[model samples]
Target: MSALIPALERQPDKPALCFGDVVLSYAQLAGAAYALAGKLAGRGRVAVWATPTPHTALAVVAGVLAGVPVVPLNPRSGARELAHVLADSTPDVVCVAPETELPEAAAGLTTLTVTLAPPADAAPLARPEPGPDASAALIVYTSGTTGAPKGVVLSRRAVAATLDDVAEAWQWTGDDVLVHALPLFHVHGLILGVLGPLRRGGTLRHLGRFSVDGVTRALTEQGGTLLFGVPTMYHRLAESAGEDAALARALGGARLLVSGSAALPVYDHERIRSATGARVIERYGMSETLMNTSTRPDGPYRPGTVGVPLPGVDVRLVDDDGERVEADDGETVGEIQVRGPNLFTEYLHRPDATNGAFAGGWFRTGDVATRDADGFYRIVGRKSTDLIKSGGYKIGAGEIENALLEFPGVREAAVTGAPDPDLGERVVAWIVPADDAAPPDEAALTDHVAAQLAPHKRPREVRFVTELPRNDMGKVMKRELR
Candidate 1:
């Protein structure tokens, strides 16, 4: 708390945030957070459900500094999801967005209404000295599709370690201005987007919701230096900027643009670079671990690889037999296990799941990848989702999808295994067509696949769709296809 306040005091006059016509200076931001801390002093856990505005940021900082765990609720979540999270976290206070009704669980709990207006005559609160093991943050939801959300407990040391690693790797400083569009409820936005920048005294411009036009205007008008987004955002931006030389020129000012939350195809990465002249850096990370590895800015940026591990991080490839594979052989593919200070402590209340994830000490990441001779790693696919067995042959869906993406007219493709009595499972391909182009027929696609892939790897069926089903972060949910 003291560190953040002192940093804010040093840059009191600097612009802290800009959304539409509203602009808040550093001092104003600090003051509002201090006052909110005063209001939430006695609260143990508070649930905040508001847009990613300046007020929301202040409230979160204040709650954390006041020794309270802030549970950032997703505004887009349905009533059932919201109820489940509230029941699980059991926050003592509920902070609702302006003009929004309080949840039923807030009947006896204190409700604080958040607004965009700055408080008057507010004084900074006394900074609390928290121990390293203090529970500084709480994110109460998991990404699993089948079960109710589970809360994840993170200590101050864990969050600090993740932010420090990111700040050092990305070369973040006070002069950088981050344009944040991801949802705050997710770890990507909270740890990487909001906390990481603020720790370095950098400013963050939060866009409550993502839209092509809104983000374009911010990049063109706000002089944003850093941009972080999912792959889908980059795809939309590429489409919006195509053939518009002026818009393309406007985007040239950004120094760094990052894509995460899902595997970014090399095709989209190249398209973004060709249109905007900004190299899109792709990285590998997950909700459990805040960040793992990234392509460095000054080093060779591999198109398909997610670069070497970040500082203070260790990665290893363990085969199905649970033995480490030699990095020299590129043919070996195994579970990409990680060990670092940034790894999550455990899955809250899921001892069995947590026990299964950790073997000997390293956290077993479910994704599968192969390390090249040069130490760069390429994520082949998820071990559980991307592995397909058909006709007594084991096939990797990611390899087939990558091959399909190499075709001239194929924009995007997803391959899944369907039930088949004869082969146990058969390959099925779902594709998105290029602009003004009809999808290739089944026979044509089959012939194209046969030309590039082995007979067993060929997709037996082809289905064309306008768009793939994605979650909020743009990760294609393959389970839905199953």
Candidate 2:
């Protein structure tokens, strides 16, 4: 708290954030947070369900400074989901902007309403000094693409570790202006997009919603020096020609560009470089552990790999039989396990799930990967039912699907292992067409794939599907396809 206040004091006149037409300087931001803190006195946990606007950012800072655990609720979440989380967290207070409705169950709890105008004569709340072991934040519910979402618990130290690494790795400074369009509820946007920049006294340009035009304008007009996005966002940017040139010029001044959340296809990597003359650095991380590895700015940029582990992070690959695999040759494949300071302490209210996720103090990532000769790591796929094993050979569905995306008329593809009596399992490909034209013939796709893959790896059957099922974060759910 002291660290943040002094920085805000130094830059009281400098712009701290710009959201749509509203602008807030550091001084105003701090003052609002302090006032909000006064309203949150005696609150155990406060739930924030507002949109990802500048006001939401203020609420988070206020909750943290007040020593109350904050839960960021997704705006699109249904009533049931909201009720489940609110009941579990048992927050003493719920804070939302004017006109927002709270869950019926929340009627018993004290509610603090906020608006664009500052509250009058709001008494400053007594800020509690938290113990080192206390929970500072609660990230509500994973995407739950495969099952019910569970809340992940993180400590102040853990969150700080991630912010520190991001700041150092990205070279953040007071002059840096970040263009943030990612949702604030997710870890990527909340920690990396917002908190990380603020820790360095940098300014953030927040977008309430994502639009290619608005993003292009912000990058060009605001002199945004950093861009953080998922692979889907990059793909959309690559699809627009007019925005492509604008993006290229806007990104020309950026020191770094990062892509995560899901695997980044090789084609997207090459296209981004061709269009912007900037290499998009791929990183590996999850909700359990904020960030583990990144493609270094001073190192060689490997296309398909997630690069080496970050400083103070340890990674090991263990086969199904529980034996460790040496990553030196790049031939070994196993479940990736990590031990780092940024790893979450546990899942909120899920002791059994938490116990099953950790082994000997190391977090089991449930990801399959192998390291190259130079220690660069490439994620093969998920260890769950998502992996496709056909003809007695293990195959990463993402690898084959990504390769198929390179074809001219193939917009997207998904590979799944289908039961086959003869071969135990056979590879099946599902495709989404690029246009109204019928999908390429199965034989033509087979021949096209034959040029790139071995016979055993080729898909034996091809099926065209209308669309692939994805979670809120846009991750394809292979379990449903199987």
Candidate 3:
């Protein structure tokens, strides 16, 4: 709602959204949202059956116009996860496109079909004032790593603040056409990818599904200036960029390439840079915080670091004893704690969880990382998953994983710790071979890691698999592997 009204007034006929064969101009989008907003004037929170479709985007826009909190339901969520979300949010109505099948979890809620097309003569209504900055605009659910997915209440202020800050940091403007094929259920896709462009009065071209072909076509043919993708998407592009001149040219032509939701391995970063003279920047954030740190366009580009904090965000590294991390030498790892306006207000209906998430005033991110003197942050790993205390030395699995990925035969690598009698916890490397017929030997990989890092940080064991389990955002599901 920050730039929606102005966009409608200024560039009413400009392309706002493109999905498949359907293209909706700003005027058309405004008309559809206004009509739906009038009908939903007095409604409470609404649940959107989030799909990579125009209808889903329209529903979210309408909800924002109506000043109603929107909960984006994952289209591919399991019955139990869906039920949990519906029950927790308890939306007054669920919105979906016509002929869309509602899951068993949404059976009892009042349902409304969002019409993709608006009447030709429907006039834009008076834009409603977004109630308050503290008012909840979205109720995005967490990944449920610890328990049931907790609803993180994001305020209108937070969304506007984060997007505005990102726009400045990335030098984003209305002239840029953003392209991505990310799922709309998460913060990266829906908020940053979709809403971010609208906030800038820019165009967005969404690929229905991610593929190297789709990315290549969008960048080369659609006048796409900015590209947003996860590590997996970039990895695919990197794997093929050397052979595909069009793909490489398309990537090299993009104004900015962003990789988020998870870290992009140093190997992939170098590969993409080698093929296309463009550096893919990484960022750090979560459902609780829309976005914390991201590599800036004007600053130095580091391969593995998730750059400095955004304009209005403040971040710090703290030790287990709740003491500030005094060393900025880039080796001492500590839990990341952040405080800023871009953070979520609370965990819906879970005050206890919310209270526990904060230490003093900073929200404990649970992600362990290191900071260099230049204020750049390098995430070591998660406190519960990535930190390996082996032989009395704390080891961050990220560096080891990066080292494993450097091997010619290693296509994918994830590092974790396993119990050992003498070492307490031993570094374990999970590898997906580039060529199964001629995978790198375990001893060679171990030596490779030891040579790159300290000998103590080397993997004690190596496990080869066809693929590593990853979530929608391309984050390796370390919990599943454990």
Candidate 4:
């Protein structure tokens, strides 16, 4: 089994984690985590009230170090969702910051307040031998589409494999300091954003809350070389960069800027690139699969396409008949199926779901995409939600969304399919107008889409709204639209 973070012991004096003024050196971090790990030893599972703080990071690291699985509780989650996770995971203890207020759902649990700094009057940094890496290390739940969120069990082996794979792909190393304002829950923010830098032996400066000024401070003042954010954050940054010179320069000077969790609309991608001279590299991943593909640091600049499969991941597209779709015409869409060490072990207490999640050992992602001749994959949308079948053509909502985004009047757009009597499924577009008072009308939008794309792919219906329903990670809940 691979060590989750093999480089931690190598750098004792280097700054390992930072949030505002709360900085922990590698020695301090290891000491604190090891100390907490002792208290958490043999605990079946530990639930963390994941706040954007060093305390949250320390707690998660401690849980993994203790050979106990961690279940991150989203701080902003509703009481019902929190209750569901707590009941489902049934963690032995819940860890939170000292001043944090526990919700009604976490009322009856054993709570452990996390203290980051090594007890001043305590013993020296006494590190222990690493624990099991191949066992379940994290039980992250998915955003439920149909039912309650199902726990996706990820192993340390999988974490190590994916991080190393991403490190190789992104040319990441110990010297690269990363910056982001992502939440401490979810895969994008927690596993990748928080633990990723730790595994690389690099410093991560959390912005706490995302803002143009916060990003500027981290990038310009904190020696941060890399930036990780979701499309929503990027969209906001892109908007600000157009007028904020400092933000633009900081972004422009960064070594790499990465966006994930949702498709970065090509419009936003170009807006940032045009201003900052930095291309936003996108990646494809899920809760069950840590990360499968990414735009490599040395690869071509292909916005809208999550680059080729990583080193150890074997990715393929399969038709409805479970046949491989070999036509790399960049048009034939198929569900992405990936097999590698990066895959999760199973869904916790979910044998039936775990059984149906894979086909002959290959985990089915349920995401439809088209792989180009060059091996780059462009995600169309989720097969169950985002793929719109109109006029007998299998159309991906991504391209249509991108087309709609190109219009000057649109600020945000979401596409889905609606059942139609004649056309089986018709494309429906939900748009947030740039100027809501002077919003573009349906006829004009339909024409604009038809002109940009083909007439058949144009939205049959357009609905204007103030905002689209999005999750904590900024991914539009397309099922809500349908």
Candidate 5:
């Protein structure tokens, strides 16, 4: 209520959100959320079945209105993962849609069904004053690359701060219409894609499922000014743009295109730009820190960089010994560390992890990156998998992956470090070939990388596959490949 209440009050009848054909105006959304909040007033913490639907959005809003922490559960989560999350979070109530079936993992929890539309007697309640800075807002779980997923406890202040910073950076306002087709469980989708527009008093059109036709129609018909997507969605748009002028026209008409969660290949970037004349801006962030850096909406566009730090965010590159690594030259690889109000308070129930995550009050992000002379940041890869030391040289897998994507027959590529007695770590590539019948030979691919980058950076071993393992947000899982 403290954040989006002003928007709801100013534009009561304006359309606030849409999913497929179902639409909810500011007044209607307020009524439904208030009605639900009355029922869930004292619930300590609740879990919602976070799907790309309006009901999920309303449930979260109700929790916010009642000053309750919300935990979003991934709908696609397997039984064990879901069980682990439920056990870890221990939510008082599990919210679901009217006709939604609870997964087996939701057993033994008190369940509540959220109705999308407000009933006749529903009314908007007067919002209270802003809560304290320490009030928990959302408990978002990590991807669990190490072991079990850790629940990142984000405060209301952190969420509001990041959203406001993004609003200023993107020049977002009430007149703009935002379109996205992303799952709602993650920060990119629910926090930015959904709540950002509401905070700006802007309209949101959520394409239920991602499709070129859906994206084109939303951008053109809904007068959408901004679009948010991961690389997979953009890759599909780029592949379809050559044959679909309407899609290109739709993309070109938009004011901004953003890609995140993973690096958008330079190949896809070029393809989309060539077809639509719009460069997709990238951003760098993690679950712990909501958003640290982003490309400005009205600034010079760089294809590979994620632009400079956002307002109120401080970013630095540090070596293994915790000394600062100056990135003025732009080729030195160092781990990214950030200190800002946008950071999460802690990992729920894991005090040791929370303490270890911060170094002298700066959160140590495991992401490796470089900064150019102009202060633009380019993420190389993850420190665990992407940093490869071979032949006494520190190489980033992202640079080589970008180089491989430029070659003729490389569709999707993931580079990882494999143990080698000679090089200490040999660069091994797992590639999804463009064509099975005419796959690029390993020697030719190696030579291609050797030409684009240094010969020492070339992949020592290349394995061709039909597809690479990807997560819900479209990031390639390099740890799995290794």
Candidate 6:
């Protein structure tokens, strides 16, 4: 309504959203949302059971339309985590689909069961004016890796700014149809995947669950132009495309292929490219900042880099002393700090956290990265877990993991620092062998890493595992590894 998502009015009859067999046009989606909005008007804050269904999307739109801040609860969260979020956010009501069975923590809240479609006899309501652009629109919670999850308060201005910036960077337009199977709880899925298409006046087809067949059908048979996914999905496609001819052809036919939420390994990037002739566009951002950088639709699809900053976003790298790391060699890594309109307003009600997040108006992102001479930024790892300090050298765990994946017998790799007497920290690798019967020998893996990277960066010890611990977004939980 604030030009945040002009598609609802601009292309009223065009296909807007699809989940399963139900396809809702812009008119239908808006009508349902407006009807629900009239019911929820003046409600303070609302919690949404963030399922990947049209009902969830409609409820979110309805809450925003009614000028209530929407808080999306992760369906996978445990009771303690759910309790913490409900207590911290203090939502007045919770909206859910008819089929959703919410956990015990949300049982006592005022619940509203959203219908799948609009009622036939209901009269069309007058379009309401939008709320203030500076007002809070969404209160997204962060993963409680270190402590309890904190709600990140994002304004309507920030969300619109990010969507517009990325729209320019990626040549996104109303003619495109976006496809993804990501969860609707987090920024990657809810904000970017669901809201992005609506803002562009484009169509969104959500795969209820990710599968090679579903993605292929959407891209080929359904006129889907853009595909957004996490690395794990791409990895599966790469693995399947070698044998599935239609899947590879469908991937090549798509106008844009995007990967985010975590770094796509260099090996998977190459594999997908070689098989499908699709270059996966990688982007970087977090809950606090919606989107920072994205590889342009124009060119230069680098394997390990996330590309340059988006429009209206200012990015800088700072060393341990907080001085700028002004090298162009792309070897020196530093903590990324950003100043932009796309950043969240504050951590909801946590003044201490909100105050600590910004350094002189630039939000200090704990992610470590390197910048090339041409302004492209390559994320190395997170400073708290993946920056391995061994023998006076600051090593990025990502590069070493890439090196390990390049070796013949490694399926997946995760690197972290372990306490060492001689070195401050020694790089330890947790590996999933390509073949369990013939796991890669420690000596061979060590030699390969020493040759690919530096000797100091090689893993001091390697432990084989069936699989690495991952979060819902498919990010390796390095904190658990340590």
Candidate 2 Cα errors over 4 Å, as ranges = 3-6, 102-110, 116-132, 241-244
The count of residue-pair clashes in candidate 6 stands at 0
Q: Compared with the true structure, what per-residue lDDT tens digits does model 4 show for residues 249-330?
A: 9999999999999999999999999998999999999999999999987889888999999998999999989999999999
- Quantify all predictions' global Cα lDDT against the true fold: 0.75, 0.75, 0.89, 0.89, 0.88, 0.89
lDDT tens digits, residue span 269-359, model 3: 9989999999998889999989999998778989999999999999999988999998999999999999998999999999999999999
Model 4 segments beyond 4 Å from truth? 120-134
- Candidate 6 lDDT over 1-482, as tens digits, reads 53566667667789999997999998888878878877777778899999888888888877777777899999889999999999999999889999677788788898899985776653334555454464688999999887899999988888888989989999999899999999999898888888899888899999989999999999999999999999989989999988899999999899999999889999999988898988899999999999999998796878899999998999999999999999968899999999998999899889999999999999999999999998889899889998888999999999999999989889999999999999989999999999999999999998899998888888999999999999999999988877
Q: Higher TM-score: candidate 1 or 4?
A: 4
Q: Which ten residues in a row have the lowest lDDT in candidate 2?
A: 1-10
Query: How much does candidate 2 score in TM-score?
Result: 0.93
TM-score of each: 0.91, 0.93, 0.98, 0.97, 0.98, 0.98
lDDT of candidate 1 vs native?
0.75
Error of 5 at 255 (Å): 0.9
Worst 10 residues of 4 by lDDT: 121-130
Model 2 lDDT per residue over 1-482, tens place: 43332365567778787888888887777778778877775677788765677767878777766767778888777767777777777777767777776666455667677554545554334555455356666555677755667888777667777777766666668898888688888788887777776777888888777777777777778777777888778777666633567666766557777888888888788777777777888888888888888887778989878988878688888888877887567756788899988888877888999999988988999998878888898887888754666667777766677778887788778788888888777888989988747677778777677677667778888888888887656667887877
How many backbone clashes does every candidate have? 0, 0, 0, 0, 0, 0
| Residue pairs whose backbone atoms clash in candidate 1 | none
Evaluate model 4: give its TM-score.
0.97
Candidates 4 and 5 compared: the better one by TM-score is 5
